[model samples]
Target: MGERGRFLLPKRKKRRHRTAVKMVLAGILLCALLLGAEHRMRPMIETVAAYQARLLATRNINDAVLDIVQEENVQYNNIVNVRQGIEGQVTSLTTDMVTMNRLKAQVTNRVSEYLEKQTMQEVKIPVGTLIGGSVFSGRGPLVEFRLFPAGYVETDLYNDFQPAGINQTLHRIMMTVKVRVVGVIPFYSVTADVNTSICLAQTVIVGKAPSSYTDIEGGVSPFISQYDYGLQAREKLPQEE
Candidate 1:
């Protein structure tokens, strides 16, 4: 080989090495940019997705409760037995386990079916929102993502007594539903617990009201009959003799 050829060989090798280093650095820079973009965008997407999941869960639960109650034509007197004294004074309240159990099962199954069929949803977020620019917010190329929600349903049947008038008591039979929704995105996921209560039936008892009885919104006292149905577990109300 000539001197010129030998000298050019090392120069070419050095240029190739420099090019390879530049290519690697460019690749690393691209990856960093992508990661940073994901970091900034993930929270916004997750927030939207979580809100959607919670909304979905709540709506389904409410629909299920309403459908079951209306379909079965349940009434306050059907599920509760109120005992009164000779003078028509309230003695105690009892829950009919059979009716309550059936209602709970129906509600749970309906809600589960609804959730299973409706868990997957699509959400489109504008790129500008992730950029956090007010001027361009909600105005950019839409980034679409799918949220797959998976979870379980728990139902509770309880009662609330509130004073209606001087001698009137307002008894409300309420059903509470809890749904655990885990929203899964491409590389991220969020969980949300949604709780909702609906009144199945209500009736005013015409008798002496309990002086210690207060509104249920504050909290339930130990004396009240509160049945929490956790997949068939029942809190037995004292059966009247």
Candidate 2:
């Protein structure tokens, strides 16, 4: 209640106001620091978000690309299979063409060999071979002939059958043989001329046959036929070959 008591009270009030002002300033400063930290971290957070987004987009793109690549590979495989099949067919067709009737007289060669080992053999005689017999021997197959154990072959023959008279029926012709008789005795072969009308006989030797012979039609060779007994010859002969 005195003057000193009044002075102490005023000083205490002033000190309290100063403390409150200091507390308010400190709070404002902390708030400003928090705002600055938030501002600095905002760009980093945005960057992280963008990075995550890019990663997700990349994954989606990769998945799409992988799907497309797999589809293309499957298509490629299918195309390759188709191509292989086509190639196989083409190769088969080519093989068939190349293998067509390659041998004319070889078809009966096996049978002839088998029969020759047992008895008389019949085989196709080559051109330019000689035939033995007369025209009155009787009609038979033009391409079939018999081979005896003496290495002599009696076969169908075709040669220059030109007749001087139209009424003079000529039967004999000439042909050549260049094959070895498997069953013949020590290969008894002779290269000579013979006379025959409807049939002929000749000697067989291990050699190539002539490509052509002088026939009534001139220069006739049965081996040259593609559609004949050869791979290309499909027409049936007038006589067995």
Candidate 3:
């Protein structure tokens, strides 16, 4: 009876050790699968999340600009002042500091509010889609993820003047917004930074175009008139006796 009991005890011990080894191997395999899935899904996840965030952010910014424009009755003249010389040439273009600043603040506040209101909205993507093969794409269960502001929404209001046609310069009031968004999945999350610009208002100025222009958006002027080039060339030429 004692010898039989001893043999049974060793058999039980071996079985338990075997079970533990199997469990450890199973755990390692599971971890490897998860890691591989994560790597494979990263690009798809980022693309989807960024697209959703950009769409939402664009809509919010447009809505905010539209609301402010309607509420404040903004116009080209209200935001910009153009000075003309005796020959009806555009000499200087100046922005109304008070109006511009006020509008900028209002836009920033409204965008922030809109983003906050939209943070709860979620985007649904299928697991099969993340797998990203011709056979498995878009064929599996859906996963829910949401976008929220990762940081403060940045808003910039500025002016852009471009030549529209001969002797015509188009003055545009532009707004650029930068939003950092995060997508939260079940156990994974991704972040993206989206930058977008919209034209709030524009007007065609009918006169001689300016030689150079400057704005808060850029230090160097984007528009250089041919008239200025001609003058510079003439000044550099040797004087006739």
Please, what are the lDDT tens digits per residue for candidate 2 over residues 23-92? 9999999999878855653443333333333333333333333443353342212211111133232110
- Model 3, runs deviating above 4 Å: 83-92, 184-189, 208-241
lDDT of candidate 3 over 20-129, digit per residue (tens): 99999999999999999989987887788777777777788788889999999988888777677799866666666677778778988998888787756577889999
Number of the top candidate by TM-score?
1
Candidate 2 vs candidate 3: which has greater lDDT? 3
lDDT of 1: 0.79
Please state the error at residue 79 of candidate 1 in Å. 1.6
Candidate 3 lDDT score relative to the true structure: 0.72
- Expressed as tens digits, the lDDT of each residue in 1-241 for candidate 1 is 6999999999999999999999999999999999998888878888899999999999899889889988999998898887777987656677887888789889999999998998479988998998776897898899899989889999887766665777666777788889999999888889999999889888886665444543434443455523211111123353222
* lDDT order of candidates, top first: 1, 3, 2
- The TM-score values for the models, in the order shown, are 0.80, 0.26, 0.76
Candidate topping lDDT: 1
Report the poorest 10 consecutive residues by lDDT, candidate 3: 232-241
Candidate 3, position 84, lDDT? 73
Error of 2 at 136 (Å): 99
